[model samples]
Target: MELLLKPIIEKPNETGSGHIKAAAPVRWALASLSLSMLMPSLSTSIANIALPTLAQAFGASFQQVQWIVLAYLLAITTLIVSVGKLGDIFGRRRLLLIGISLFTLASLFCGIAPTLSLLLAARGLQGLGAAMMMALTVAMVGGTVPKERTGSAMGLLGTMSAIGTTLGPSLGGILIAGFGWETIFLVNVPLGIANLLLAAHFLPADRPNAKTMQGRPDAIGTLLLALTLAAYALAMTMGRGSFGAVNIGLLLATAFGAALFLLAQAKVKSPLLRLSMFRDSTLTAGLAMSTLVSTVMMATLVVGPFYLSSALGFDAAEVGAIMSAGPLVAALMGVPAGRIVDRFGTHRMTITGLVGMIAGLFLLSAMQGRFGAAGYIGPIAIVTANYALFQAANNTMIMTDIQPEQRGVISGMLNLSRNLGLITGASVMGAVFTFASGVADITAAHAEAVAAGMQITFIIAALLIVATLGVALAGLAFARRASLLEEVS
Candidate 1:
C-alpha cells in the first residue's frame, strides 16, 4: 500500500518563501484564473438577459433560446477534463495562453455570428477555451505559490471567482441594455486579450518529467470519456419525458463509454484519470461535496430568474439585480470562509455551510405567492451566504489533500464534477419547471405551479445538503479518532 501511494504522494519541493517573487508570474496566473472564472457566470447571466432579444432577432423559440445557454455549458463540461489532462501532459502555462487566445477568437466569432447555429457553435468553442483556462489555473497556482502561503493565495483566487459570479449577470445586463447582445461577447475580447498577455509574461512554464513527456495520451480513453459526458449532458438537457429513441441511445452509449473508459484506465500504463487518487478518503469526500454543492448552486441559477421574472414580474435588469444578490454575498463571504477553513479545519466549515444552505433552500421553498419582491430578500441573502461558505470550504478541503503533481488532474476532475452537477441541476429544474408550469398557465395560475415545482426542487437540494452535513460530521469523527490513535501509539 505504501509503495502504491508513494509515487502518488511525492510532491515537488516547496518553493522557499523568501525566494517567491511577487512580480509577474503570480499576478498573471491570478488574472487568468479570475477572468476564466468570470466567463461562465458572465455568459450565463448575459444570455439570460439577452434571451428575449435573441429570440426577437432570430425568431427563435423559447426552447431554442434555452439552447443558447445549454450549448455553452455542454461545451465546457465536455472539454474540461480533456483540456485539464492535456495541461498536465503538455505545459499548463502553454495551454493557458492557447486557451485564452482561442477564447478571445471565439468571442469575436460569437459577437459577429449571423445565424443561431453559428452563435451556438461559437459559444461552444468559447466554452472549450474557458475550460482550458479553468483546468490549468489552480494547477498553476500550486506550481507557483510557496506551500506556506498557498492557502491564502487560493483564498484570493476564490474571492476573484466570487466577484466574477456577482458581476457576471449585473454587468451583462448593463451591457446588453446599453449597447446590444454583441457587447456581451465583445466584453470578453479585451479581458481575454489582457489575460493572454499577462499569461505569456508571468505564468511559469511547465517542465514535464521524462516519463510524462514520453507517454502517449490515451486516445481511446479520451474518446470514451467524451462520449460518456456528451451522452449524459444530452440526456439532462433533453429532460426525461422529452427523451426520444436517440436520447435513450445516447444514455446507453454514455454508460458503455464510462465502463470502457474505466476499464481502459485500469489497464493503461499512463491513465488520463488517475483512479488511484480515489484511495484517499478526504479527496473522495471533497469531490463528492463539490458535486453536490455545485448542483444545488446551479439550481438557483436556473430557477432564480424564472421565479423573479414570472412570479414577481421583474424584467431583465430587475431579474439581474435579484440574481446578483447571492453572488454578492458569496463574494463577501469567500475570504472569511477560507480563513476559517484554514484555522478550524474543513469539516466544521463544510458542515456549517451545508446547514446554512439547507436553511436557505427551506426558506425559498416556503415562499408564498402573495409575498412581494421584498419577501424573497431573506431567502436570496441566505442562499448567497451559503454559496460563499460552501465554495470556499469545499475548495480548501480538496486542494489540501492532493499532492502537487496530482493537482492538475484532481483540480480538473473536481471542476468537471462541478460542471456536470450544474448541467444536471439545470436539466432537472428545467424539466420540473416545464411540468409544473404546463399544468398551470402563468396568467391563470400566476406562478403557483412553478413555485410548487421550485419548492420541490429546493427540498431535494436541501436533502442533498443534509447528506453533505452527514458526511462532514462523519469525517470529523474519523479525524478525531485518528488523532487519538496517533497519540496512543
Candidate 2:
C-alpha cells in the first residue's frame, strides 16, 4: 500500500510552498487535469450529435432523446457549485477520484442501457460526475504547478476544453457511422480509466486544513442554490427559442429560488457561497466580464450558422467547415494567449483581448454578403483568438490568489457564470437575430433579411464587448487606486 500510494518528488508550487514540480510528475498531473477538463466539455457536445441515433435505437421521440443531453446539462448546472463546496469540505483529491469513477461507470452504463429511461439515468449520473470534475480541475491548478506558470496551465486547460468541444461532433459522427452510437459513450471508458490512474498518481495529496475541517456543509444553501440554477437552466432551454408559459413560470421560480437562496446564505452558519467574496472588486469585475464575454461569444455560435446558410446560401458542409474555424482558432491560441498574459500581465492582456473582440464584432456587424466566406471567417478568427487570451487572463486573474479553502467554490462560480452566459446567448441572441430579420421563421428568412439580422445581431454583440471592456478598465483603475492608497498609508 505504501508503494502504491508513494508521494511524487516535490518542488515549489504556486504559493512557493512544496508540491510536485518534477517535469515528469508535473506533466502527468497536467495530463490528468487536462483530461478532467476535456471529458465534461466533450460530454456536453458529444451527446448532441448522437441524439438522432439514440432516438432511433430506442424508438424514442425527439423530445424523449433530448433528455439524454438535457439531463446531463441540468445536473451539471445545478450541482457544480454544490459539489465544489463539498470538495473543499471533504477532500478534493478523494472527491475527484470518486467523480472519475462515477463518470467511467456511468459511461459504461449509458453505452449498454437497453431502455431510454435507463440511459437518461446514466446520463444524469454522468453529469453529476462532470460537475465535480469541472468544479475542481481549475481549483487544483494552483496546487499542481508553479505560481509564475499558472497562466500557462490555465491556457492548457482552456485549450483542452476547446479541443473537447470542437472534436465532439466530428468524433461522435465517426463513431456512430463506423461502430454505433454506443461507441460514443463507450469511448470515454478508456480515457476515464487513464485519467483516474494519472490523477490518483500525480495530483497532490489533500492536506488537513483546520479551517476547512471546522466548517460545516451548508445543506439548506446547497439545496436552494441547486433548485435556483435548475430553474434558470430550464427557463433558458425549455422553449427551444420561443418563450411560453412554462418558460415564464420557470423564470419566476428561478427568481424566487435565488432570493430564498441568498436569504439562506445570509442566515446559514456556514454558507455554500460566501457573500463577502463579492466585495473584492477584482473578483466581481472578473466574473462580470466573463459572463459578458461568454454571452457575446455565444452570439457567434447562434447567429453564424443561420447567416452562412440562409444569407450566403452555403451548404451545410460549407457552413460547418467555416464555423469550425472559431473553435480551431481558440484551441490553437490558448497556450500563446497564456504566454502573453504571463509576459504582459492579465490586466493588459485582458484589455487587449477585449479590444480585439470589439474590432472583430464591429467588422462582423458591417459584413455584407458580397465579401463571401473570407469576410466572416476573418472576423470570427480574430474574435476567437482574442477570446482565448481573454479567458486565460480572466481565469488567471480570478484564481491567482484566492484563499485555498475557497478555491473550489470560487472556481465553480466562475464556471457557473460562463454557463449562464452561454444559455442566455443561445436564447437571447437568437431572438435578436430573428427580430432584426423581421421574420417569424429564421430558417426560411430571405438572404437580405438574414444579412440584416446578422449585422444587427453583431452590432448588439459588439455593444456587449464594449460593456465588458468597461468592466476591465474600471477594475484596473480601481486596483491602481487601491494600490496607491496602500502605499500612501
Candidate 3:
C-alpha cells in the first residue's frame, strides 16, 4: 500500500496516453516486468516440445505423459483467483517475490526429479508461481506507469509472451539436443534467480489493502473453485485420450463443482472471486474480447501447425519454422499497436484487428491449393501482427476501467479468461478436426480428410472472430448509450 501510495507516474492526461518521462527508471521497470513475465510464458510452450523426450525417458505412453503439461495448467487455473486476492490483501510485491522463489525451487526439482510423477508435481509448483507472477505483473505495471502509457506497458508484456511462446520450441530443441532434457528445467534456475533479484531491487513494495487485509480467505469458496477449475482443465486436456470413466467423471464433477463454486461465492464473507467486478460493462466487454483473441490465436497455433505436418507431410522442424512467423511479426508490432490503442481507442483498434485477423484466417483456410510452408508464413504473420494490435487494446480497455485496489483481482480475472480461452481452443479445435475428418486418430487420417478438417477449423475460428467483432461493437454502443442516459438524467 505504501509503494502504491507513492506512484512513480501520476494519472495520465485526459486522452489517457502515458507520459514519457526520463527514460532511466521507467525503462528499467518496463524491461524487468517484461522479462519476468516472459519466463512463465516460455515455460508454457517449451514443455510441449519436450514431451516426446520425456515419454521415452520415463517409458510412458503419450497419454500418461500429458500430465506434465496438464498439471502445470491445472495448478495455475485453480490457484490464480486466490493468489490474486492474496496479493491485494498482503501486497503484490511480496507475492511476486515469493512466487519467483517458488518457481525457481520447483524448476530445480523438475531438473533433478527421477520419476515422471515427481516431475509432474514439480511442474505444478512451477505453475503456482507462474500464476502469481501472471496475476500481479500487469497490475503492478498499471499502478506504476502513467495511465496513458498503460496500453504500451501491456503491449510490452504481450510482446514478452509472444516472444516466449514463439521461441520456446526452438529453445527447447536446442537445449535438449545439446545438454539433455534436464537442461530445459535447469536453465530456469539462474534466470529465475536473476529475475528475482532484479524484481526485488526495482519492483515497488506493496501496501496492505484495507478492504481485504483483515478478512479471512473463504475456505469453502477456495476449495470449490479449485475443484471446479481443476476438473474442467483436466477434462479439456485429457479429452483426446478418449472419454473414459475418469475423464467422464471429471466432466461431471466439473459441472457440480462449478455450481458449488457459484453457490459458495454467493454465500462467502470475503469472496475469492468478486462477481461484482462484472458490473463494469466495459470490463466485461474487455474480458470477452480478450478470451476471443486468446482462443483464435491458440487455435491458429494448433490447426496451422497440424495442417502443415499432417496435410503437407512436413517435418516438425519445418512446421515449427512456418509457425514461427506469427509471433515474430507480433513481437515487432506490439509497441506500435499499443500506441494505436492509446490514440484511436480500443474499439476502433479492436475492430481493425478483428477484420485483419478474419482476412488472414480466410487466406489460411484456402491453403488447400498446394501451398508450401513459405506460403503459410505470410498469412500467419499478418494474423499474428493483428493479434498484437487486438490484445494490447483489449488489455488497456480492461485495466483502464479497474480501480487501483481491485487491479490485482481483475488482472487475475483477465489472465483467467485468456487461459480458459486457450483450453477451449485446444480442446474444441481437436474435436472439430476429429469429427470433420472422420478419423478417430489424427496420425492415421488421410491427407484429404486432414486438409478438410484444417479448413473447417480455420473457418470456425474465423466465424468466432466475426462474432467477437460484433460483441465489441455492441458493448461499446451500449456503454456509450448508458453514459448518455446518465448525463441526461
Candidate 4:
C-alpha cells in the first residue's frame, strides 16, 4: 500500500490545462477508479454464484434467497440518480469517499451477519454505496484524464467491470469450496480498503460549481423518482416468469408514480433530474441506445446457459466455461475499442459498433445447428467485442461535453438506463425464449426445442439492435440540423 501511495501522495503535477499529464499518476488514479467500478459488479456476480449455498445455509427457499441479489440491484437502480444529484450538490470527491467507506463497512457487515434479514439489509446499504460510485466515477473522468483520452478511460473502466463480473463466478466457487459462503462477502473487505486509500489519495478534489450549488436538492422529486423506479423494477422482476395481477398492479403504480414524478420535477425549486436535459437530442438518443443495447446484451446471459447445457449437452463446468467467453471478450476488447473511438471519433465508431452487433446477431439467429458450439461462440464474441466499442463510444459521445454541474446526474442516468435494460431483458427475453420453445418447463425441453428458442431469441435481439442503429442515425441527423441552424442564427 505504501509503495503504491508514495508516488501519488506527493500530488500529481498537472498540465497547464489542469489534466494529469504524468502517466504513472494517471495510471494510479485510473486504478483507484477502476476498483470503484469493479466492486459493485464483483459484489453482484459473486453473490449470485453463492445464492444456492446461502439458501441452504440459512434454511431458506430460492425465492427468499433471491432477495439477497434483488435488494442490492434495486437499491442501486432506485438511488443512483438521487445520489448523483447529491454528488453534484455536495462534491463528487467527498461523496465518493463516503460511498467507498460505506461499501467497505457494509461488506464487513454482510460477512458477519447471522440472520438472512441482516445480510439483505447490509447488501442494500452496499448497493447505496455502489450507487454513489457508479454515478460519480465517469463524471470524474473529465477531471482526472486529458479530455482527448476520455474514451480510453471509459474503456478501461469497462474492462474492469468485465473483469469483476467474469472473475466473480469462478472466484466465488473457489472461495465457497475453500472457506465457505461468508468468505465471498469477506473477500471484498481488503480490496475495498485498498480502493478507498487509492481513491482518497489520488482522485481530483471536487471544485464547487456555483451554478449547481445555488439551492438545496429537490427532496420531493427525489422521493417520487425513487419510488417510481422501484415500482417499475418490481413490476418487471417480481413475476419470475409469469406476469400476473401483482405485476399489472405494480406496473399501474409505476405509471402513476412516474406521472407524479414528472409533475413534481417541473414544479420543484431544484429537481432530481432537470426535465430540460432531455431536450438535448444527443443525450436523449444516447440514453435510449444504451437502454436498448443493454436489453439485447442481457439475452446472452438469460439464454446462453440453458442452450449450452440442454441443446449442446454440455456439463455444468463446460457451460460455465462457454459462458465466460462473453466477458472475456469484453475485457480483451475494451481498450482496443476505446482506442478505436479515439482514432476514428465517437459518432462514427458508435455507428460502426452497432453495425457490427447487427451482423453478429444475424449470424446467431440464422446459423445452422450442425455447426454447434463454434457457431455460438464466434457470433457471441463478435457481439461482445462490438458492445465494448459501442459502450465506450456512446459514453464518450454523451459525456465529452456535458456541463460540469450536470455530469454526476447525467452519468447516473446513463447507468440507470443500462440497469433498467438488464432487468427488462431478463424478464422480457426470458419470456420470449419460453414462449418460442413451446415448453411449459424449460428444463424438460427437448434439444431441438432449446435450439429453436435460442435462434428465435437472437432474432428478436438482432431486431432490437437494428432499432438502436436507427436511433443512432436519428441522433446524428438531429445534431447536424442543430449545428446548421446555429450557424444560420
Query: Per-model C-alpha lDDT, please?
Result: 0.73, 0.89, 0.82, 0.90
Error of 3 at 152 (Å): 0.7
TM-score of each: 0.86, 0.95, 0.93, 0.95
Ranking 1 against 3 by TM-score, winner: 3
Q: Can you give the lDDT of residue 279 in candidate 4?
A: 96
**Which clashing pairs does model 4 show?**
none
Question: Which should have the higher TM-score, number 2 or number 3?
Answer: 2
Candidate 1 least-lDDT 10 residues: 1-10
- Residue pairs with backbone overlap in model 1: none
Tens-digit lDDT string for candidate 1 (142-196): 6665554444455556666767666766677678788988988888899888878
Q: What's the candidate order when arranged by decreasing lDDT?
A: 4, 2, 3, 1
Worst 10 residues of 3 by lDDT: 1-10
User: Model 4 over residues 169-208: C-alpha lDDT tens digits?
Assistant: 9999999999999999999899899988888888889876
**TM-score: model 4 vs. ground truth:** 0.95
What are the root-mean-square deviations of the candidates from the true structure over C-alphas? Answer: 6.4, 4.2, 4.1, 3.3
Q: What's the count of clashing pairs in each model shown?
A: 0, 0, 6, 0
Off by over 4 Å in 3: 1-22, 241-245
